[model samples]
Target: MSAPFRDEEFESAWRELDEPQLEGGWQLFTEAMGVTIYRRYDEETGLYEYKVLGVLTSCAPARCADVYMDLEYRKGWDKYAKELYEKDFSGRSAIYWEVKYPFPLSNRDYVYVRERRDLEVDGRKIWVILARSSPETPWDEKKGVVRVTDYRQSVAMESNGACGTKVSMNYFDNPGGLIPSWLVNWAAQTGVPAFLTDMQKACDAYGDYQLRK
Candidate 1:
């Protein structure tokens, strides 16, 4: 059985991911693809987590939301996706993602459950999409691949005046083993921009791709 969704626990995540405070230790990391990125060090995990916010220019919220829901298209823009398939009812899924590492660094793989829900935030509607690795799925020992165990991620997007969408997310995955903190930091530093860039591209191409179908 899936873990019960505790109201308070989710509420906490909602606040952190949706109503972020860009104050204090949250430092600006990068800005690109119309996205602004921020990060803060977490002493508990010894990892720097990321907070990203952006608006996809001229893109509707439904389009942004649907692009995320449509898994196949994800394979095209997401360079890391190896396979994406549903494992159960609802939006629960298993995504096999391959992380591209520089020469001599072992690539990584993550098998996680990505779930989504539409809910109200501050009287406005938004989509709360969450993902994390499931313990039920045992780690496959693949050659030259490191398994990511500690992972938690969420994307929260709300419509902007019916014309565009405001997107925000928090992503962190602890790739177990001897991976250096600097490398992890570098990934977080660069990954956010690429993700938002592709998302915007996907939003732009989605319409044309459908018209031809």
Candidate 2:
């Protein structure tokens, strides 16, 4: 995953996004709080991961992006995050991010490149952002954390003509430790939906949390 943005990995991801789900083969993991979750096996590469699609009725595309890239905002909603920040940026959009997990689990982090683009389809502007984990920056030890390299996530949002956004995310991560498969499955199924709920709530308050000039 050391490749830079727009490289082969990203190119492939862009194409896959056109189809996002693996068609009728993708199993429905859960659907709640307006977020419909799906899962599939990818044992050849990483563990079981989720592909989530839903609508955030309270936010616009810009607000969604703002909440995602703003690390401080995450602290207010992302409960699993013990520590989160971006540093040692690769140019302007790619950077290193560290995440400290909670107790009983090894902390894992990521290096992701943020790619954004706007598409015009049928006279409508659609915005998409993909923040994918890149290994271009070498992994370094953080006293009590385990480095997680196998992580990928992307978001595509299009306005729904009512100020809301239709969003989708393809995310997967491999926690490098002795954790059981069942536990990993449980965490993904439970954590992702909760994350989305918190995200939607945070997005509702984005304007209030805007940084002052």
lDDT of 2 by residue, 128-167 (tens): 6667666666546577777777777767776756978777
What is the Cα-based lDDT of residue 44 in candidate 1?
A: 84
Model 2 regions more than 4 Å off: 1-4, 7-20, 89-94, 211-213
Reference-based lDDT, each prediction = 0.73, 0.69
User: Considering only N, C-alpha and C atoms within 3 Å, which residue pairs clash in candidate 1?
Assistant: none
TM-score of every model versus the real structure: 0.81, 0.82
Q: Write the per-residue lDDT of candidate 1 for residues 104-158, one digit (tens) a residue.
A: 7778777777667777877877777777876566446588788777788877777
- Backbone clashes counted, model 2: 0
Model 1 residue-pair collision total: 0
